[model samples]
Target: MGAFETLEPEDPRQVGRYRIVARLGSGGMGQVYLARSPGRRLLAVKVVRPELARDDEFRRRFAREVAAAKRVNGAFTAVVVDADPDGSPAWLATVYVPGVPLNEAVAAHGPWAARSVLALGAGLAEALEAIHAAGVVHRDLKPSNVLLAADGPRVIDFGISAAADASVLTRTGSVIGTPGFMSPEQLVGQPIGPASDVFALGSVLAYVATGVGPFGRGAPHALHYRAVHEQPDLAPLPPEVRDIVAACLAKQPHRRPALAALLDWLTTMDGSNEAPTLRLSEPGWMPDSIARLVREHTSAPLLHTPPPALPGTPPETPRPVPGTPASVRPSAASQPPAEPPGPTVAPEPKAHPAPAPAGEQHEPVPRPSVGETHSAEQRTDPATPSPGHPSGRRPRLSRRLVLLGLSGTALTAATVLIAWETRDSGTPSTDPAPEPGGKSSPDGAPGTRRWSFATGSGVDSSPSVAEGIVYVGSNDGKLYAVDAGTGRQRWAFPTDDHVGSSPTVANGVVYVGSQDTKVYAVDAITGRQRWAFPTTASVYSSPVVADGIVYVGSGVKLYAIEADTGKQRWASSLDGLAASTPMVVGGIVYAGTSFQLCAVDADTGKQRWAFPTSGGASSSAAVAGGVVYVAGWEGKLYAVEADTGKQRWTFSTSGRVYSSPTVADGVVYVGGMDHKLYAVGADTGKPRWTLSAGSEVSSSPTVADGVVYVGSTGGKLYAVKADTGELRWAFSAGAALISSPVVAHGVVYVGSRDKKLYAVYA
Candidate 1:
């Protein structure tokens, strides 16, 4: 975390509209204060000191700094949140850099791993790119000026050197430079450009990798002498990054790699002549020791309750800054994907039935044959019929047609599988979801509102949270990574069609299906496409990632795709559309099809067994205690043995069952068009309890902390007592609550027809 100090009596309790809470430190311009906005946002507000405020020239310079800071907006650099230049004491507030500075991190955690150094370089390069594009140069680039946040490294004190007039340094009558990090050109007082930052970046990275400056610490004059005339001590750097750091430390700036090329070089540290994508937000990016320090700052409540009074803590001011500079510090956390607790119900994916594709129109056929067969795409030869079809002569129809004829519909998690529980892997996330039950903010109490993210269209897709980012899809045909806490959009990846499939996060990649018939593997941190596996028809099925393989359904086939490569390992042809999200357990994948619940080999994609059923399988399946629990379009919840595909029990609901089942503590929970959420005995298939939602219950129920969190078409999210089916509370959304509610860290996330994703208390 960035350094913090107790507020002094001299510090203002209020800066403009910001409520000053504590002292950040002293900078050249004046004292820096940490403040909070009414919106609950923590910001760093820089106030001009009385001495500098009286200097008319300093006011102009401070004004320029505010404008310049506002112009340079980058993920790795501070973002100016608000500023007031003409006020009594001109102040500027920017997003806080909450993590520890590079110097402190190195000193505390020893040295970072090679990859961390590379990540730092990439982050710094990106910052430089943004700063230079805004026509500003951050001449003061040093270890103390770089903050290592959970998301990535952040560069601070940018554009301050440019904002300062040379006379200010003369007025101090003392040289002001962090000598170890100062570039040769700046040391010799030669005119500097953007490349000057590159030299400083090299020194910072060298410090991170070796825990010492390349120029060796000494007096400012000796440090400058070594920087301008000596070759940096690069022998200590790991070979993977040594050459690149050497290139950045080139005495002549022209020989250094451009910021653009610097990132390209960072990726190919192995000298393989091939650049592999590196995701900096991966779990292991920062060593466990240092990452814990960052997590503590990031995961803590957004604002620290300001002490009752300014304590005797020392100020964190730099020894000297010639011209006043803004000091802002805000913290961010690493987002870990929702690994839910207890049993979780998977929401039924939405089935699109109207206006079928011209070539894929439906035709009247026997009910059994119509519901249990493959799509026309798989039956390329008209003379041949899919053997999996109950009646070989039955015509092929899209999966949607089967749904319209049998189950009707439910989804945007009443639509996202990676939309629902263990959607992609089918393995239930345990314990983690309930951990936040205690000591959570009142905002997380039953039905309390937190935030909502508006999308281009309804967000039917379920959301996945990981590494401080929330991954969700929208009918808008874009997959958005949003800040789970702030509801701010981080990035959006465009798709050709609606992305109704819920996202599955594994390793450092996010996998999901699109109606466009492609399953994409994306870099979780960067939102860049790593690979796309093409399919034959609309892929309404969400993906389950396991053991380097991505298992998903598209049309009549279950595909085992190489997670890293877009290559298909094998495709298992089903007699009917395998539209349900697949769940893999014990090397066997359990998935529902229009005609039956199919068991396939996880490795070879070979069909292990298929259990025949009437109508079709409309919802995804859940497995627990050696049995698979799946809901049928015919309103039957079937409990079948996972290994043999033999039925153990069947519980019939009042109406069609589109909501997937969640098995926890020997109880199977599911929703139905009958407007009820039911808890059935997993072994006996006997109804334990049922809560009438007052509207159709399409979204699946997620059980955590002895409660069931579910959504209804009536647009309300309900928290019910798991044991007795007692309703604790309900929160109304703007539209249909068709999206299955997902619980993570005491918060419930669900999408709605109102084109928004709501985060409420669980």
Candidate 2:
């Protein structure tokens, strides 16, 4: 809790140029040691795992990220001092903060009062402002990463951070960071920026104010899912702070207030006519209990003797210093002869292992993979619907005329069935049908609908919904746009080869890739080709558009094309074939190849960094909180750093992984050829649950409304609870299902090898 523990025999005596004095703590990556520099300055040296040290790519990335981290300097942040990524064990050193972690402090002394929490928020916001100014994003900003010093809070752990301009280090499609405090975009694998940190700050401040995470504590996946789609529980927060915290927790990153803006808000929390100030140095800023604990921990004896006192200085005494509170006095003997007045230690806190902070470190509760049900008690909030419930609020009736637009008898029959089911239950229907052309329900859940669109060949591309239309591609070389409320095709545009890449609709244009070595931009409404960009080889990587640029990978190169003109902007070479789709965020483009995961500048297509993998990666990358989630064909799922391409952790599946991972809450969901669907931890890569399927599973999972919907090669579409992996229901497609599932309007849409696209109730 104090960042120092007795060094065990197994711990190394030294790492790089530092002598290890004690252990700080262990994370998923490696052990952090409290060590002293050659000059006797305290440092926290994080030694890399042996396996990671042996990885040449990891070592290279580690060095780069360390260099980037060293550039970060701020009052509320621990400064990186040195590192030796090429060392035998590899290590990085940061200024050792002599304070208790926020989690530990909160656990021992209870939640901080409103005034202290406001000060904490202001300091943290300033820290984020500095971090972002350095072009860095502290992806993991949680209570545990914060140190509560006498002066203020210090944010630590750049283990999963990245520079804004640096290449991402994470594997494609992996999620990183603790779940309870992650931002909505991080949970959904969206591009993260400084705004993401603001969201995390909101979560942390909420925890400090309410003693629990804003999203609550439970299965990480559930928490992450809630972060993405549900409103945080601010009911316990004080009225003065609730609105600001709520604004910070907005689902859209752009909606969240900037750090500077947030700092301004925090300064006026007391409703005082004078501007509220963050005075950490002032007495009573921190609660008395926490101050005593800080004093006790810092006053603990040093592992080694301090340098002699200056010649003319009066003999140092264990007395309270002016401006320092009586409850938090410095230890005279622990101070260095020439150093400035600061918190001093007495002796190590009896080597007592502190209790793990709530929601900090605990073995994940393994959930059953098969059928399990949640009772009323399991769902205590009526506002939070139970799993399988389409809407959280009670159902309501909508105008029946909304169904009149059905284009086929099949949809009419399905609507009739829905009416019959509601009537037969003998319970008044409280759920309303979707608005005539809306894609989502009142509660943001997909509405129930039944429709089928048959193509000339199997449809492997997942459906993308826009403007009441569903766009999908098929092996028959055609992109089809079908009515959302019915199964009628609005238009079909033919390509030269199979359309395997999912369509991305933006600005009235549909962008997709084909096996024919071409990327096409077609008008969404007319299905007319707007423009086409040709590559040297097949383009299986889906195109992502940002700022009028289209990023896609084909064969051995990643290309940036003008979205409107289809003219090539730039192209960067890759180590192997581009096997997955490209993700563009924060001016960076991430793509997976047969042999590596690469990041490039979105505008110039200049290579930023690439992390080599043991095998080819066909799984598309998901970027969240400075981590990339990607799977190798060799059965391993990896979480890599986004800025420097450093490997954070990996989870091995029994079979090959071709299905891309979808992250929700704190869980990464993906299917494997081992005929199983797995729920893996986004931060630690630990397994939460696994559900066995009848055959190989190559379909990526989609999570919504607390349910995970995925298809298997065994021709079945499964609906499982996102929190527990419990099977809710299954639908047979009569053929192998290779397409990923999409949920909209309470309907699950997936393609089957039988040449049909089916839409059924979620």
Model number with the top TM-score: 2
lDDT of each: 0.59, 0.59
Cα TM-score per model: 0.45, 0.46
Instruction: After superposing candidate 2 on the true structure, give the runs of residues whose Cα lies further than 4 Å from its correct spot.
Output: 1-3, 172-175, 270-278, 305-762
lDDT of 2 by residue, 1-762 (tens): 432355555677767767776665554346777677778887877777675577776677677777778878888888888888888888878887777777767866777788888888888888888778877888778776787788887887763476666545554212335556778666444578888888889988888888778876422222443576568999999876788889989989899998877888887784332222337655676889988887887786655622334777432222222221111111110010000000000000011111111222111222222342211111011222111100000000000000000000000000000000000112222333323332333343332336667899766565665566777777688888877666677788888766656665556666777756688777766677777778765444555555666666654567777667777888876655543556554677666655567777776777888776554454666555677777775678888897898999999998656666666676777777677889998899999999987666666676666787777666677889888989887776646666666666566777766688777677
Q: Evaluate candidate 1 by giving its C-alpha RMSD to the native, one decimal.
A: 27.1
Tell me the tens digit of each residue's lDDT in model 1 across 586-638.
68777676556788887777789877544446566666667877776557788
Model 2, C-alpha of 373: deviation from truth (Å): 22
Number of clashing residue pairs, candidate 2: 34
Q: Model 2: C-alpha RMSD to truth?
A: 23.9
